[model samples]
Target: MTFRIAILGASGYTGAELVRLIATHPQMEIAALSADRKAGMEMAAVFPFLRHLDLPKLVKIDEVDFSRIDLCFCALPHATSQEVIAKLPRDLKIVDLSADFRLRDPAEYQKWYGQPHAAVELQKEAVYGLTEFYRDEIRKGRLIAGTGCNAATGQYALRPLIAAGVIDLDDIVIDLKAGVSGAGRSLKENLLHAELSGGTHSYSAGGKHRHLGEFDQEFSKLAGREVRVQFTPHLLPMNRGILATVYVKGDPAAVHRALEAAYAQETFLQVLPFGALPSTRDVAGSNYCHIGVTGDRIPGRAVVIAVLDNLTKGSSGQALQNANLTLGIEETTGLMLAPLFP
Candidate 1:
């Protein structure tokens, strides 16, 4: 069966990506596209790269007939996503690519997002959308919340180590370098070519990044205790990818072993040979996350480097993965495309 799909926030980066992937999906069809500000415009006008495919014109959220959509991918922004999703048909399957339903605790959601969750019940019911870790839950979930690109990168590096008790819980550090696309397509003076093209800088540092909340929540849950990691995100001059260099107190070989074993069966996650590393360019525009491990100069310390295209594996691609599971389709459908390489 061709599952009918609706993509809200269709004018944005993630939304456009979903359209690109689903355009070739054998089991999914784009039934509707919504872009409140860009309503009535052709998606081809918004993203010329997609002009080759015929897609529905962009409409407003209220204009979509959710009753006909088998699954909806909510690529809208933070608070707005929850507000829109709250009014969506509760029976409709949803894969939210925003920060709205990621945190289960409404209090934590407020603490990180600076507002009480408008859809607390739905938040409680949404499954975390890390396909590798939450496959079973996603397969049965009505709503699946996609992870922050930064958070997903760090987790891909460290989750297995933590689960295997091979890493130091108290002294973890995630130094991430991401392209401007991860900030979304919104116009920012800092993101302009003149301002960002020649340099690199850190935005949310000193535990101020919102994804830290996700790291704290997920890591703590795995370790059965409070696990806080120092996370600093830097914006690179490039366009699309995230490279997270995670430092942990552990044996490099053991950390490598744990990750290899955990991801051995995962289709999109690749752990490289020991002492090797991954580059963002290797995984650009693809749904694959390449991770590498090596020991630091300090004997007990290990460095885990993970990379993926923030727009693909990080957001839109991850959203599609969850949607497939929720719809009882193959988890990797339309997502096994090879990474773009120069």
Candidate 2:
């Protein structure tokens, strides 16, 4: 049976991406599209790349008939996401791509987002949307919180090592470089072509990046103790991917093997040969994550490099993956497209 889907915040990048993917999905149909500011406008006007497909006109959230939608993908911004989702049909299946429900603890939400979560109860009920790690929970979940692109990339590199106890837990570092698209489509003076075209710089440094909260929460939960990782995110001049270079104290061979074994059966995760590395361009515009491992000159040290399209595997693609599970469909449906390469 084809599931009817609604995409809120349809005018944004992630929302447009959802349209692109779902347009080809045989088991899902875009029943409604909502874009508060651009209500009544055609999605083709906002994203001409999608002009080939016929999509519903964009409307406001309240204008949508949630009762008719089988599943809804919430792509609205954080603070607003909770307010909107709180009023959505509680029984409706939701795959939220915002930061609103990622953190289970309201205290941690407030600490990182600088505000109290408006939907505390839903926050607690929303399952983490790391597809491979939480597949079972997601299938049974009513709401799934999509993880941060950076957080997801880092976890793809380190989660297996952490679980296998092959890496030094206390000495982990994630140095990530992300394409500008990860910042969202909102206009910022710094994101202008004149300002960012030929340069790059780290924005959230010194433990100031909000996604660290996810790292702390998830890693700590995995280790059954407090696991704080040193994470720094850099904004690159490019437009569509994230490459996380994770440093860990472990045997490189063992780290590679752990990741290989963990992701051996995972459709989207590809662990490369030892000493091999992945490039963002290799996974651009695709729902795949390519990871590589190499040993450092120093003994007991390893470097794990993980790459993915921030817009695809990092966000929209990940959202769709969870939606499939929630609807009891094959997890890889409409998501096995090969990455774009120059």
> What would the TM-scores of all predictions be?
0.99, 0.99
- Residue pairs clashing in model 1 are none
Alpha-carbon lDDT of model 2: 0.94
- Residue-wise C-alpha lDDT for candidate 2, range 1-342, written one tens digit per residue: 999999999899999999999999999999999997789999889899999998999999999999999999999998999999999998999999999999988999999999888988888799999999999999999999999999999999999999999999999999999999899988899999999998889987999999999999999999999999999999999989999999999998999999999999999999998998999999999999999999999999999999999999999999999999999999999998999879
Q: What TM-score would you give candidate 2 relative to the actual structure? A: 0.99
Off by over 4 Å in 2: none
Whole-model lDDT values for every prediction: 0.93, 0.94
